[model samples]
Target chain A: MIRTKDIFKSFDEKEVLKGITTEFYKGKTNLIIGRSGAGKTVLLKLLVGLLQPTSGEVWYDDTNFFSLNKKEVRAIRMQVGMLFQASALFDSMTVEENIRFPLDMFTNMTYKEKRKQVDSCLERVSLSGVNDSFPSEISGGMQKRVGIARAIVLNPRYLFCDEPNSGLDPKTSIVIDELILDITKEKNITTVINTHDMNSVMEIGENIILLYQGEIAWRGHRGEVLESDNEILQDFIFASPFLQRLRESALGK
Target chain B: MFLKNILYHFGRYVMMLGTAISRPEKVSMYYKETMRQMNDIGIGSLFIVGLIAIFIGAVTAVQFSYQLDGTLVPVYYIGYVVRDMTIIELAPTFTCLVLAGKVGSNIASEIGGMRQKEHIDAMEIMGVNTAAYLIMPKVIAALVVIPMLVAVGAFISIIGGYLASVPTGVMADADYIKGLRSFFDPFNVTMMFIKAVVFAFILTTVSCYQGYHVRGGSIELGQASTNAVVFSDILILVADYLLAVILTS
Candidate 1:
C-alpha cells in the first residue's frame, strides 16, 4: 500500500500537485486520472520518489519514502516496478536480454536459471517465442506487453505504469487493462497507474482520483463514476454529448 | 552570467564524476559492460585513427620540407622534426580532437537519446546507479584504448613521413633514417601518452555529463551533443598546453 499525506509539489514558480492525500490500496488498480496539464504525472512521480514533495510526506507502507538514505531507498525501489509510457526497453537488447536485465544486475542466478526466468515472464505475457526480437521489430501493442513482461520480471510488490494504454487501439487498451488488473490481483501488489484513458478509468479503476488543476476534483470507484454527479467529473468524463446522452438513457432519467 | 554558468556546470560535472566512480551493484555486470565498451571504443575507432594519422604525418613532413628549402637547416631535419612533432603534439592533440568529434559526440547522443527515451529513468527505478553503469565503462575503455591508438598513430605517422619524403627524393632514404635515429628523446613519447590519457578523460567525461543531465526533447539533445564535442575539444587544447609546460619543466 502507498499513502500520501498532504503532498504538494512545485516546479519553480508553478505548483503542480497541491496537498494530495490518498491511499492506494494493495491488490487493487488505483488510477490517477486527469487532463493534459492537471498534474497526474507529477503525482505519480512524487509517489515513486522521483520528484520530492515540496511539503508533506509519502509513505510506501510504513516507510517514509523521502527520509531514507540512498542505500535504503534503493532497497525499497527493488520492490518497485514501473512501466514508462514509451516502454523504455533497451534498443540494443533483445526481448530475452531485456527481461533478464534485472536478474542479471541484482541476482546470483546462473545463465540457465536467468533464461528460464525470462521465458516464464514471456509466457506470462503471452509472448512466448519472441526472445530474440528487438523492440523495433514489434508492434506498439506488443511492445506494451513486452514492457509489462520486463516490469514484472522481478515480481515487484508495487507496480507503477505511466499511461500504459496510450497509443493503443480500444481493443488493445482493454487487453492491457485486463493484463494489469490480472497481475495486480494475482500478485496482491499495490498498482498505481497514471493515465488519461477514460476507458481505463471505467474498466480497471477499482479506485480512482481525478485531478483537476492540481487537486483532486473527484474520487471514487469505477462503479460510482456514472452516478457521482460531481460537476467537474461530469464535465471531464462525460463531456461528449453522445456519452452524456448515453449516461442519461442508462440512468433511466 | 557567463562565468556563473561555467562554474555551475563545472560543479555538476565534478559531482557527476564522483558519483560515476562508485562500486557496481554486480561486478560481473560491470565487467560485461566494460568489455562491450572496449570493443566499441577501441576496435570501432581504428580505421579513422589510422587514416587520419597517415595524412597528418604526410602534411607535416611536406610543409617542413618546403620551409627548409634554401635554408641552413639540412633537408634530413624534416624526418626528425616530423618524428618529434608527431610524437609530442599531433598524434595526441589532432587525433584526440578528431575523437572528440567522432567518439565524444557519439557517446553524448547515445546517452542523451537514452535520457529522452526514459531508459535511464527505468534503470534508476530498478535500483541501479545510472551514472556509474552508463558512464564508468566508457571512461575506462577510453582511458585504456585512446592512448594505445595514439601510440599506433605515432608509429604510422613516421612511416607516412618516410613514404612522403623518400619516394619524392626530398631527402635520401639513408639521411632520413639517420635523422629519425638522431637526438630521439624518450620524454617526448611520455608527453604523447600523457596528452592522450588526459584528452581521453576530458572527451569521455564531458560528453557523458552533457548527455546525463539532458532535459526536454530533440533540440536539447542536439545541443548537448554539440556542446560535448565543442567543450571536449576546447578543454583538450587547454590541457595540452598545461601538460606541455608541466612535463617539459
Candidate 2:
C-alpha cells in the first residue's frame, strides 16, 4: 500500500496540490481522475517520488520515501513500475532491448535467462514476434503494450500508469484498461492510474479518487460516482454532452 | 532564472559523475557506452577526415610551390608545413569542428529527443541514474577518440603533401627532409596534443550539456544542436588564442 499524508506541492507561487491526503490500497485499481491541470499528474508524480512534496510524508509500506536518501529511494523504485504517458521506450533500441533494459541494469541474470524473461513478458502483453521491431514501426496501442511489458518485467509490487488511455480509440482504451486491471489482480500489485476517461471509471473504478482544482472532490467506487451529491463531480460528469444525456436518463429529467 | 537553472544542472552533472565513479556497475556501463560512442565518433568520421585532409594538403603544397617562384625551396618543406599545420592546429581544431557538425549534432539531437519524449523521466522512475548512463560515456569517448582522430588527420595530410610535392618538382626529397628535421620542435608536438585534448573536452561536454537540457520538442532539439556547434566553435577559437598566448609566453 502507498499512503500520502497532507502532501503539499507548489510551483513557484502556485500550489498545485493543496494538503492532499490519500491511501492507495494494494491488489486493486486505484484511479485518480480529474480535468486537465486538476493536479492529477502532480499527485501521481509525488506518489512515485519523481517530485518531492513541499511539506508532508509519502510512505511506501513503512518507509518514508521523501526522508530516505537517493539510494534508498532507488531501492524502493526498483520494487515499483511506471508506464509513462508517452510510453517512453528508448527509440534507438529494439523492442526486445527496451524490455531487457531494466533487467540489464539491476539484475545479474545471464543473457539467456534475461532473454527468456523478456520473451515471457512480451507474450504476456500479447506482443509476441515484434521483439525486433522499433517503437516507430509499431502502432500507438502496441507501444503502450510495450510500455506495460517493460514496467512489469521486474515483477513490481506497485504499478503506476499516467494517462494510459490518452490518444487511443475507445475500444483500444478499454482493452488497455482491462489489461491493467487483470495484471493488477493477478499480480496483486497496488495499481494507480491517472485518467479522466469515464469508460475506465465504469470498467475498473474499484477505488477512485476524483480531484477538482487540487483537492479531493470525491472518493468512492464506480457505482457511487453517479449517486454522489458532490456538485463539482456532478458538474464534471454532466459537462460532456454524451454524459449529459446519460445523466438525464439516469435522473429521469 | 536561466543562470540558476544552468548552475543547478551543473551541480546535477557533477553529482552524477561522482556517482558514476563510485559505483562499480555504473562504471562498467559507462565504459561500454563510451566504447560505443568512440566507434561512432571516431571510426564513423574517418572517411570525411581523409577526404578533407587530402584536399587541404594538396592546396597548401600547390600554393607554397607557386609562392617559392623558382627559389631553391625544398619540396619537403611542404611536407613539414603540412605536418606542422595538421598536427599543431588544423587536425585538432578542424576535426573538432567537423565532429561538432557530425558527432556533436548527433549527440545533441539524440539526447534532446530523449528528453522531449520523456524518456529521461522514465529513467528517473526506473531508478536509473540517467546522467551516468547517458552523458558520461560520451564525454569519456570524446576524450579518448578525438586525439586519435587528430593523429590520423595529420598522417593523411602528410601523405597528401608528399604526393603534391613529388609531382611539382620544387626541390629534392633529401633537402625537404633536412629542412623539416632542422625546424622540428618537440614542444610544438606536445602543444598540439594538449590542444587536441582540450578541444575534445570542450566539444563533447558543451554539446552533451546543450542536448541534455533541451526544452520543447523536435524543433527545440534542432535548435539545441545548432546552439551546441555555435557555442563550441566560439569557445574553441577563444581557447585556442588563450592557449597560444600562454604557451608562447
Candidate 3:
C-alpha cells in the first residue's frame, strides 16, 4: 500500500500538488483521473519517489519514503515498477534485451537463465519471436506490452502506470487496460494508474480518485461514479455526450 | 543571476562527482562506463585522425620546402620541424578538436536523450549511481584513449612528413632522419601527453555535464549537444594557448 499525507509539490512558485493526501490500496486497480495539467502525473511521480514532496510524507507500506537514505530509497524503488507514458523502452536495445535489462542489473542470473526469463515474459505479454526486433520496428501497442513486460520482470510489489494508454486507439487502450488489470489481480500488487480515459475507468477502475486542478475533487468506486450527484463530477462525466445521454436515460429526463 | 545559477549547478556537479567516487559499486559502474566511452571515442575515431595526419604531414613538408629555398635554413630541419610540431602541438590539440566535435557531441546527445526519456530517473530509482553508470566511463575512457591517439597521430605525421619531403626532393632521407633524431625531446613529449590527458578530461566532463543537466524536452537535448561542442572547443583553444605559454616559457 502507498499513502501520501498532505503532499505538496511546487516548481519555482507554481504549486502543482497542493497539500493533497490519498491512499492507494493493494490488490486492486486504483485510478487517479484528471484532465491534462491536473497534477495526476505529479501525484504518480511523487508516489514512486521520482520527485520529492515539497512538504508532507510518502509512505511505502510502513516506512516513510522521504525519510529513507539514498541507499534505502533505492531498495524500495527496486521493488516498485513504473510504466511511463512513452513506454520509455531503450531504443538501442532489442525487445529481448529490454525485458532482460532489470534482470541483468539486479539479478545474478546466467545468460541462459536470463534468456529463459525473457522468453517467459514475452510469452506472458503475447509477444514472441520479436526478441531481436528494435523498439522502432514494433507498433506502439506492442511497445507498451514490452514496457509492461520489463516493468513486471522483477515482480515488483507496487505497479504504477502513467497515462499507459496515451496515443493508442480506443480498442488498443482497452487491451492495455485489460492487461494491466489482469496483471494486477494475478500478482495482487498495489496498482496505481494515472489517466483521464473514462472508458478505462468504467472497465477496470476498482477504486477511483478524481483530481481537479491540484486537489482530489471526488473519490469513489466505478459504480458510484456514474450515480454520483456531485455537481463537479456530473459536469465532468456528462461532458462526454455518450455519458450525458446515459445519464439522461438513467435519470428518466 | 546567471552566474549564481552556474555556480549552484557547478557545486551540484562537484557533489555528484564526489558521491560517485566515494561509493565502491558506483566506482565499478564508472569503470565499465569508461571502457564503453573509450571504445566509442578512441577506437571509432581512428579513421579521421589517420586521414588528417597524412594530409597535414604532406602539406607541412611542402610548405617548409618552399620557405627554406634560397635561405640558410637547412633542408634537413624540415623533418625536425614537422616532428616537433606534430608531436608537441598538432597531435594533441588537433586530435582533441576532432574528439570534442565527435565524441563530445555524441556523449552530450546520448545523455540528453537519456534525460529526456527519464532513463536517468529510472537508474536513480534502481539504486544505480547515475554518474558512475553514465559519466565515469567516458572520463576514464578519454584519459586512456586520448594519449594513445596522440602517439598514433605523432607516428603517422612523422612518416607522412618524411614521404612528402622525399617526393619534393627538398630534404635527403639521411638528413631528415638526423633532424628527427636531434629534435626528439622527452620533456616536450611528456608535456604533450599531459596536455592530451587534460584535453580529454575537459572535453568529456563538460560535454557530460551539459547533457546530464539538460532541461525541458528533446529540443533542449539538441541545444545541449550544440552547447557542449561549442563550449568544449572554446575551452580547448584557451587551454591550448595557456599550456603552450606555460610549457614553452
RMSD of each: 1.1, 2.6, 2.2
Evaluate model 3: give its TM-score.
0.94
Model 3, A1-253: lDDT tens digits are: 9898998999998999988888889999999998789899999888888788899999889999999987788789889887888988889889998888777777878889999999988888889889999999999999999989888888899988999999999999999999999999999999999998888988899999988889989999888977788877788667878879998898788
What tens digits encode model 1's per-residue C-alpha lDDT throughout B70-176? 99998779889989999999999988999999999999999999999999989989999999999999999899999999999998999888889999888899888
The regions of model 3 sitting more than 4 angstroms off are A251-253, B19-36, B245-249
For all predictions in the order shown, the interface RMSD in Å is 0.5, 1.3, 2.2
Q: What DockQ do you compute for every candidate structure?
A: 0.85, 0.63, 0.51
Any runs in candidate 1 off by more than 4 Å, and if so which?
Answer: none
Task: Write down the TM-score of every candidate.
Answer: 0.98, 0.92, 0.94
Best by TM-score: 1
lDDT of 1 at B140: 94
Q: Pick the candidate with the highest lDDT.
A: 1
Q: lDDT tens string, model 3, B112-143?
A: 89988887876665556677668777787889
Pairs in clash, predicted candidate 2: none
Quick one: ranking by lDDT, best first? 1, 3, 2
lDDT-wise, the better of 2 and 3 is: 3
